[model samples]
Target: MRILKKILIVLVIIIAIPLIVALFVQKDYAVEREIVINQPNEEVFDYVKYLKNQDNYSKWAMMDPDMKKTYKGTDGTVGFVSAWDSDNEEVGKGEQEIVKIDEGRRIDFELRFYEPFESTEPAYMTTEEVSNDQTRVAWGFSGHMDYPMNLMFLFMDFEEMIGDDLQTGLENLKSELEE
Candidate 1:
């Protein structure tokens, strides 16, 4: 009976440690990447405002070329939604809706992911004039995990993972716009 009690205590402590650690771990994560595109701010904003254009520059959009895509409302305007489905685990299934637009400056999107995992996050892109023909484009994404799930942040480098994809997309965007 004493041995059984000690075994139970050891197991409880092992599990409790993680839970205790989770309480202090951050729940929210945000990542941003930027690039310089050889295009005017208006021109860059115009292209990014249209979510459909992402197919040409977004790394995830190009992940599965055959992924099914659907759209709603008018592109480049508020309330437009671009949804994609793919058999690839990395691509999974998700819908991104244009929540707001700041004319030639920025566009905000709400991303709802369904398959693989469920999450609703916010993403945005901003264009600023660097020179008469140069535009600085910034892409950002932020999400929050609940409770113990936030503990994953300790082990997972969400910033690096998501930032890499954002940087790749921005680099692709720069190439597409420059060409």
Candidate 2:
């Protein structure tokens, strides 16, 4: 009986530590990355404003070339939605819609994931003119982690997980634009 009590105590401590730590972990997370492309600001902005063009440089879309995709509304308009579904674990299923657009300056997206898990997040892309011939493009995603699920942040990496993909997507965008 004493040994069992001791084992129970140890197990409680192990689980308690992480639970306690999770309480203090930040609930919101954001991932962002930027790249400069030699193309002019308008040129870069025009390319990204059209959601369909994403297939050419989006790292996530590249994950599953055969993934099924569907579109609604106009491609670059504010209500346009691009949804994708894939049996591939990484791609799973998700839909992104243009929530706002700042002409040739910025575009904001609302992202909803439904496959492995379900959540809605905000993402955006901005274009800045560095010079007549150069443009800076920034891409970012942000969302809040819910309750006990946020606890996973203690062990899982937020930046490395999605940030790498964001960075890669930016790099691919740069290359595509410069080409």
Residue 6 of candidate 1: its Cα lDDT? 100
Clashing pairs in 2: none
Residues 49-98 of candidate 2: C-alpha lDDT, one tens digit per residue: 99999998999999999999999999989999999999999899999999
Off by over 4 Å in 1: none
Candidate 2 worst ten-residue window by lDDT: 146-155
Q: How many residue pairs clash in each candidate?
A: 0, 0
Across residues 1-179, which tens digit of lDDT does each residue of candidate 1 receive? 99999999999999999999999999999999999999889889989999999999999999999999999999999999999999999999999999999899889999999998999999999999999999999999999999999999988999999999999999999999999
TM-score of 1: 0.99
Give each model a TM-score.
Answer: 0.99, 0.94
Model 1 residue 167 lDDT score: 99
Residue 4 Cα positional deviation in candidate 1, in Å, after optimal superposition: 0.5
The number of the candidate with the highest TM-score is 1
